[model samples]
Structure formats: structure tokens, C-alpha cells
Target: MENKQRLIGIVLAILGASFWGLGGTVSDYLFRHQNVDINWYVTARLLVSGLILLFIFKLLNPKLTIFSIFHNIQSTIQLFIFSIFGMLLVQYSYMASINYGNAAVATLLQYIAPVYIIIWFVLRKKANFKLFDLIAMLLTISGTFLLLTNGSTHNLVVPSSSVIWGIISGLSLAFYTIYASRLLVKFPAILVVGWAMIISGLLMNFKAPIWQFSITQLNFANVSYLTFGIIFGTAMAFFFFIKSLNYLSAKETTLFGTIEPVMAIVASAFWLKVSFLPYQSLGILLIIILILTLSLKKEQER
Candidate 1:
């Protein structure tokens, strides 16, 4: 039974990674190949996904109460912020950065999240200040740097604005991880995620004048993108992620998550012709090593 559960956990983790991988590559497709604007794509993500999940909840568990979901207003707000700032902003800003700079640089920069999380923990005094953590942090940063520099230049040449914004994206992710863990301890994870999506969708509607809501302009192509984003990218991936959380240790879960960027690299390489510079490849390798080492150490300590 233990082995069976572990196998299920492994499958869930892979499914989660696969869905995330699909989401990342699909973002490029919607933007470049399909001519779908990022704004529209985000808006569609919120609306379509939220509604679909709501219907699923209604059908599967009719006793579920919307009022019950609202009982933890603070957690709900944090979850919504997770969707808006953590997920939505990251997605939008990432696309913007790539457009402003290039995908290679943008991706390398956005991945600076692990470092930000360390900083976040340090500032909050939640994590022990240890030499290994510091070394791991340095390794993560160096990896990101190597990825960007492609092992070519001693001096990094990233724009200050892109760097700053990328850090903000990482900050948001750090907050999401910390806060989501806190909230999940007290509430149903699905309610937290679903309401968060609804709020995020509403927030996106007001963020810009992107979703025109024109039935006339809607086409099969755009709908196709929308369907893919909501179903495959948002709902299914999130479901598997939550399910995996139920069966795996957090350390095991995150180790498997390394699969996401790997999938990103593979898809980008195959479809987008995005290749790594030697430095960039070295950096990615280092980051993976750091995560593996630190995570394993933590798990053993526990």
C-alpha cells in the first residue's frame, strides 16, 4: 500500500508538471502563433476556468456552499491575490519581458524565485540562517546568472527594469508559497483555489481594457486557445497539484516540480528553437543541483 501510494504520488507529480509545461509553451503559442494577446489570454484564463470549476463543484458536490467558501475571508483574499499577483502578474509580466527583451533572458530572470523565497524567509525570520541555505541561495542565483550569460560574459548585461520586475514576480511567488501553505492548513484547498480564480478573473477584467466581450469577434481559433488554457492549463494542472500534495511529502513534491522548467526547456527548444548558451545551461544545472541538495537535506533533517 505504501508503494502503491508512492506510485500514485509520482504520477500526480508528473501530471502536474506536464500541465504546467503545457501552460508555459501554450503561452508562447497563443501570443506568437495564434495572435492572441496576453491580456485576452489571461482574462480568458480567469473567466472560463473559474466558471468551469464552479460548475464542476456544483455537479459533483451539490452540498458545497459558496457562503462556506467565504467564511475565511482573509484566506480567500490571499488566494485571490495568489491568482492575481502571483499567477496573473507573473504570466503577464513574463510575456511582457520576453517581448521587451527576449524569451531566453526573460525566462532566466523570472526563475530567480527560489532566491527571492530565501530572502523572504530570512526577512521574516522563519528560516534558520544556515551556511548551507546561503550556499544554496548563491547557487540558485549563479545558475540564473549562468543561464542569462550563457557562460559567455563575466559581467551580466540585463536591463535594470527587467531585473527589478522579474524579482517582483519572484516575490509574488514567494508570498504565494508561504501564504498558500498557511491558508491550506485552515481551509479546503479547492475552495481556496476556485474562489481565488474567480476573484482573479474579476480582477483581470478591471486590470485593462483587453477582454472586449464581443461575441461577434470570437472565433474558433481564439476559443481553442481559451479552452486549452482553462481546461488543461488551469483546472487540470491545479487539480493534480493539489492531489499530489495529498500523497507526497513537500520535499518529494518540489523535487518533482523541477520537471516544469525542464519541460519548458524541452518544448521551447523543440518548438520555439530556444537554445541555451553554455553559461545558461550551466546556470540551470546549478540551480537544479542546489534545489536537490537543499531539499534532500531538509527532508533528512525532518
Candidate 2:
């Protein structure tokens, strides 16, 4: 039974990561070709995906009340913080990065979240700065430098705005990972994620009013991409990832989640005809090694 469950988790993790990766590519297409507004896109994505997730949650666990997370004052505050600073910020920054750059670079940049997690732990005195941690940090810095500069200190391969947004996305993701884990101890993953998405979506509406925006390039392809991004990319991706946690350890799940950037890079290359310089490719390899090293270290420690 345990082996079967683990097998299911492995499949779910791969599918979830693949969806997210391909979703990034799809988002790139929309932003570059479909003339989709970033604000409107993020707003609609959150609202629609949140609604779909909540519907699934209700169907899967009808006895559990979704509102229970709001019963406590502290939990309510944490939820709001998670929604805005973590969920909303991650989503917006990621999309902005993709808009400014390509999906491959954006996804690779976001993969540096584990480095931030290491730094946070060190600062909190929760963990010591070990040799592996130092190596991971160096790898992250070097990889990012190569990726941004493409091995040239004199020039940047990507826009400065894209790098900034990508880094912010990584930071927000680190926060999301840490804080969401805390919340998950008290609430189900679906409930917390669903509410977070809805809360963030509602908050975003004040700034970008999805109802007021107009898409001039509305076509079948655009609509299909949008629908796929919302349904498969956002809703199903989150659902599958969360469900995988039921059968696998967090470390295992995250290790599999690295497939996200790989998929994004491949999809961007073929589907969008994006190209990476040789040095940038090396940087991507280093970053992947860094992630694997950190994940393996954590697993060994456990």
C-alpha cells in the first residue's frame, strides 16, 4: 500500500511540475503574442483557479468547512499575509518576469528559492552554515550571475526588470513555502491554498479590476491558452502537488518539482523558439545541480 501510494505521488509530482513549466511557456506566449495585460491576467488566473480549486476541495472533503481557517484571529492574519505577500506576490512577480524575459530564465531564477530558505534558517539560528549550505549559496550566486550576464560581465542578456522580478518571485516563493508549511499543520493544503488564491485574487481586483480590462486580440488560440493556463497550469498543478504530499515527504516532492524549470526551458525552446547562449545553459546546469544538492542534503539529514 505504501509503495503504491508513493508511486502515485511520484506521478502527481511530475504532472504538477510539468503543468507549471508548460504553463510558464503558455504565459510567455500570451504576454508576447496575445497582448494580455499582466494585471488582468494575474487577476483572472487567481480568481478562476481559486474558484475551481475550492469547488474540487468541497467535492473531495465535504465534511470539512472551508471557513474554519478564519475562525481564529491569528490564523486569519497569517492567511491574509500568505495570500498577499506570498501567493499574490509570487504569481505577479513570476508573470512580470515572464513578460519582461522568457519563461526559461524566469523559471530558472525562481528555482533559487531554496538558497533563500537556507539563508533564512541561518539568520534565525535554526540551522548552522554548513559546508554544503555554503556550496549551495555559491552555486546560486554564480549560476544567477552567469544566467543574467551570459558569462559576460559587461552586458546583461536579459532586461534588468526581468532579473528584479525574478528575484522577487524567488523570495516570495521562499516565503510561501515556509509559511504555507506552518499553515498546513493546522489546515488542509487545499483549503489554505484555495483561500489564499481567492483572497489574493480579490485583493488584486482593487488594483487591476479584471472586469474593466479588454483584450483586443481575443481569438481561439488565445482563449485556449488562457483556459489551459488557468485549469491545468494553476488549478491542477496546485492540486496535484498538494495531493502528492499525502504520500511523499516534502523533500521528495520538491525534488520532483525541479522538473518544472526543465519543462519550462524545453517548452520555451521548442514552442516559443527561445534560445539560450552556451554560458546561460551552463548556468542552468549549475542551478539544477545546486537544487539537487540541497534537496539531497536535506533528505540525508532527515
Candidate 3:
């Protein structure tokens, strides 16, 4: 039973990671070809995915009401902060990066969150910086330089704006990873995420109304990509990732989740015809290894 459960978790993790990776490719397609606005895309994905999650949660737990999170003032404030700074910022920054660059670069850039998290821990005096942490930081810096320069110090291969947005995405992710830990422990992932997403979408609608999109502007292909992003990428990906925690340790889950950037790079190179220099590829490998190392937990830490 234990082995079978672990196998199931592996499957879930793969599915979740692949779905998220492919979503980046879809974002690349939408931003490059379709006349899709980032605001509309973010708002729609959050609202629809959040509503679906709420529906599924209510279906699973008939006695637990979805409105329970709103009853607590502190929880409500936390949800608002999470929705605005964590969820909204993360989504907007990631999409903005993809809009300005290919999915491979944008995805890899966002993976720098682990490095940022380590920095935050060290700064807060919550963790003692060690040799492994030093190695990870060095790799992160060197890899980022190579990724941005693509082996040429003469010029940046990726746009500066894209790199900025990608860095913001990583920063937002790090904040969410640390801040949401307590909330996640206190509440179900679905409940917390559903409310946060819906709230974010609704709040953003005031400035960039999602209801203003014209139906004629959305053809079949455009609609299909958006549907895949919102359904498979946003909703199903979150579900599978959360479910994998039932059988896998946090380290195992993170190690598996690293597949997301690998798949994203592959999809971008093949589907979007993105090419990288030899040094850039080396940088990619180093960063991936760094992420894998980050997943390792020391005996004391664990």
C-alpha cells in the first residue's frame, strides 16, 4: 500500500508539473499571436479556476461551507493580502514575463524563487547559512547571468523588462511560499486558494474589467488555448499538486515539481522554436541542479 501510494503521488506530481509547464507555453502563444490582454487573462484564469475549486470543495465536504473563511476577520485580512500581493502579483508578473519573452526563459527565471527564499531566511535570522546554501546561491547568480547573457557579455539576450518581471515573479512566489505556509496549515488548500483567487480577480476587474472582452475576438483556437490554461493549467494543476502531499514528503514533492521548468524549456524550444547557446544550456543545467539540491532536507531541518 505504501509503495502504491507513492507511485500514485509520483503520477500526480508529474501531471501537475507538466500541466503548469505547458501553461507557460500557452501563455507564450497567447501573448505572441493572440490579441489577449494580460489583465484579462489573469482575471479570467483566477476567477474561473477559483470558482471551480470552490465547487469541488463544497461537493467533497457537504457540511463545510465555503463562506467559513470570511467569518474570521483575521483570516479575511490574510486572504486579502494573499490575494493582492501573493496571488495577483505572482500571476501578473509571470504573464508579463512571458509576454515580453519566450516561455523557456520566463519559466526558468521564475524558478529563482527558491534562491530568494533562502536569502529571506538568512536575512530574517531564521536559518544559518551553510556551505550548501552558499553553493546554491553561487549557482543561482552564475546561472542567472548566463541565462540573461546567453554566453555573450556584450548584450543581454532577454529583454530587461522581461527579466525584471520574471524577478518580480520569483519574489512574489517566495513571499507566498513563506507567508501562506501558516494559512495553508490552518485551512484546506482549496478553500484558501479559492477565496484568494476570486477576491483577486474581482478586485482587478475594477481597473481592467474582464467582462469587457468581445466574443468575436475569441476564435476557436484562442478559446481553446485559454480554456486549456484555465482548466488544465490553473485548476487541475493545483488539485494534483495538493493531492500529492498526501503520499509524498515536501522534499519529494518539490523535487518532482522541478520538472515544470524542464518541460517548459523543452516545449518552448520545440514548439516555439526557442534556441539557446551552449553556455545558456550549461546555466540551465546548473540552476536545475541547484533547485534539486534545495529540495534536500538536512536531518536537523527535517
Q: Using TM-score, give the best candidate's number.
A: 3
Ordered by lDDT, highest first, the candidates read 2, 3, 1
Against the true structure, candidate 1 has what lDDT? 0.67
How many backbone overlaps does candidate 1 show?
Answer: 6
Q: State the lDDT at 119 in candidate 2.
A: 92
Error of 1 at 113 (Å): 2.5
List of clashing residue pairs for candidate 3: none
The most accurate candidate by lDDT is 2
**TM-score of every model versus the real structure:** 0.83, 0.95, 0.96
Which ranking of candidates, highest TM-score first?
3, 2, 1
Q: For residues 252-300, write the lDDT of model 1, one tens digit per residue.
A: 8877876766676677778788666666678778866775675567524
User: What is the Cα-based lDDT of residue 191 in candidate 3?
Assistant: 90
Supply candidate 2's per-residue lDDT for 76.
Answer: 96
Misplaced by over 4 Å in model 2 are 1-3, 213-216, 299-302
Alpha-carbon deviation at 115 in model 3, angstroms? 1.2
In candidate 3, clashing pairs total 0
Preferred candidate (TM-score higher): 1 or 3? 3
Comparing candidate 1 with candidate 2, which one achieves the higher TM-score? 2
Q: Worst 10-residue stretch by lDDT in candidate 3?
A: 293-302
